[model samples]
Target: MEEVKFGQDINKQKHKKMNQTVLITGASTGIGLEMAKQLAAKKFNLILVARSAEKLQEIQKHLQDQEGVTVKIFAKDLSNSANAISLYNDVKRENSKVDMLINNAGVGLYGNFTETSLDAELDMIELNISSLVALTKLFAQDMLILKSGKIMNVASLLAFLPFPYYSVYSATKAFVLAFSETLAAELEGTGVTVTTLCPGPIDTPFNTDSMLTTNAYKANKPMPASVVAESGVDLLLDGKGKKLVGFNNWFISNLPRFTPDFIMMKIKKNLASQRK
Candidate 1:
């Protein structure tokens, strides 16, 4: 019986060693953090990237202690194209095979496009669209060589509609959705899959300062970050193409397509007005 138990322990160690490694951006908090936790529980080695080095270290230590999965942390400001490239290069330098990539780093500004700070908007674009594309291209090449990888691009339900106040953010997410879907098709049969996650307002640090005070935010209870993270990871691993979290969010995302343009615009305008 002791020998049998020892064999079982050895098998578990072997299984853990065989687990794939996933790299996640924005992994210090919110959906990214939750996704890391879930994946760690599953024994996937983790490479966590975020601007907050302290937070990343904290999480890395905790997850390593709890799940016994390897955790690597990189603090990078992906808003800069140079930094985004550096991140990919650094990962390559480590000789780590990234089995999955989560493009979750993003920012949003709330206000009229004209009134919003131009610098802030540009930074958002760099982080949301440019960085996402750069990272995808860089890692995707490696994945192609391996012929096995999964990618999850975190878009938003706002991608489907014209958001008056969140103009640039909405536009970026729209690009993500379109880019992810097209890439999924292009990569078909290549053993690499792309999944786009369009979640509604999520209760994360990302929203705490900006969106949480709005009436629209209040009207719809923000989905817990863990719930969204779990759903997204599930879809990504399943090789699903596009997923919108929450029934209401899914309905809203689809509703805009059928609604009249003017009516849709008015509704969006009203929702935007709720921001204080």
Candidate 2:
């Protein structure tokens, strides 16, 4: 679907309740895509952003055809920090007012720090941290000006329980959790709220790959993306503050508080390494 021009009425569209639009990044797959589907079911217009134009278009058409809602797709590789700002500009120019922003795009590496490619880790950092910050800042400003909007930043269970093999990825998520907590407090009375979603291992495209077959990863059963997104959508729309998905995940995230750091790290390292 083409971008909505400035003069068009957002509420007068065919879908009666699709006036409020949600912008979701990494929407071609995984939690991001699942959240998009759920939001569409709730009659929210969608602005889906991802790297693959073909995939984005496919989802766009699927949603529009099935839900009778406006679906706009933007193909963007947000790993490059500048692209985040560019995306914000493009949305504004297209006259799309994002009522909610979901920073769901991220990357993870499953290998020893020394063994993993430096470039890959750098790209992961750029996508997981830099772009998230850029988009949150840009859109959060817009929301403040309007005095309305919700933002959901997807962190990981590893945000609080950083594992060894996923060093950089875990660190990036930790930043997301910390940043969202502070920002939520700052925007408390502004009417705009920020929510952090911390999911443990997810049955998303990222983990289905054979790359993460370590003993620790295999031991922990992953939650379905649909289930996690269901909680995420509700928390973002109806509730506020950080949400740790599932009881087990919440328990694991708090283990660090009870167990000493050095002992916990050793245990985490053992779990992250392959069986010898």
Candidate 3:
């Protein structure tokens, strides 16, 4: 596979045409919201999970009216970790099965590791790693029983190149990367596919306009949330392998292979840190 900045090769791109119900975590905002919109447009039934009940209600009504597809919204604070199983049970009670699962909820605290609040970072771990794993474990077992399903785990470019300020956040995503890739390999013959979406600095509230100061923002720029979501939804339904969004991002994910740890850290520091 050529790691070109020209974007994913059109020849290799896949977009399967199947109507499957998709449940997306963090579906009220940013990349998650964008994903919900794209999937709804494609006529897939949706199960949207987020922390905002009001926002979820609005989204449910809008998607239901506009797309004319069944939209189920669950207001869940998956940061609790234990709530992952509860949410799963809740969804199963309402709906018999989930054809696809998109684990997109995550949080990050930007600052020196020691300066950051331990409580906040711990909660982030629960949302970004623990809850994701819990849901994946639960849903994956069901998928294996049915002998068909897809799971999309959202990681980050920082997963490959750990940044200084986002130490805990990046580590969690690194865990996602390894966990997803290994799980994908494990589920190869089980008819349940696990695909990872590793997007770079996306122009979402999560990424923020403040990120313009970073070298990464200058070098790769911020891809629109819609673009990333489109790619993710397409990959999810099409049953493609892992995707790392952005042109420069694909190269960035592979840089660590050739660059020394010190040099890589310096570059990632510049990319993630404030630029003068």
Best by lDDT: 2
Pairs that clash in candidate 2? none
Rank candidates by lDDT, best first. 2, 1, 3
**Across residues 1-276, which tens digit of lDDT does each residue of candidate 3 receive?**
466633555323322323468999999998899999998887788999999999999999999999888888888999998889999999889764699999999987787888889999999999999999999999999999999999999999988888888899999999999999999999999999999999988877776444567777788878889999998988897856689897789998899999999998888887777777
**In candidate 1, which residue pairs clash?**
none
Q: What C-alpha lDDT values do all the predictions have?
A: 0.89, 0.89, 0.88
- In order of TM-score, best first, we have 1, 2, 3
For each candidate, give its TM-score against the true structure.
0.92, 0.92, 0.90
> For candidate 1, lDDT tens digit of each residue in 169-260?
99999999999999999999999999999998988877745567666686678899999999988987784888989998888878777988
Error at 2, model 3, angstroms: 40
Name the lDDT value of residue 19 in candidate 3.
46
How much does candidate 2 score in TM-score?
0.92
Error of 1 at 54 (Å): 0.8
* Cα shift from native, residue 58, model 3 (Å): 0.5
Task: Show pairs that collide, candidate 3.
Answer: none
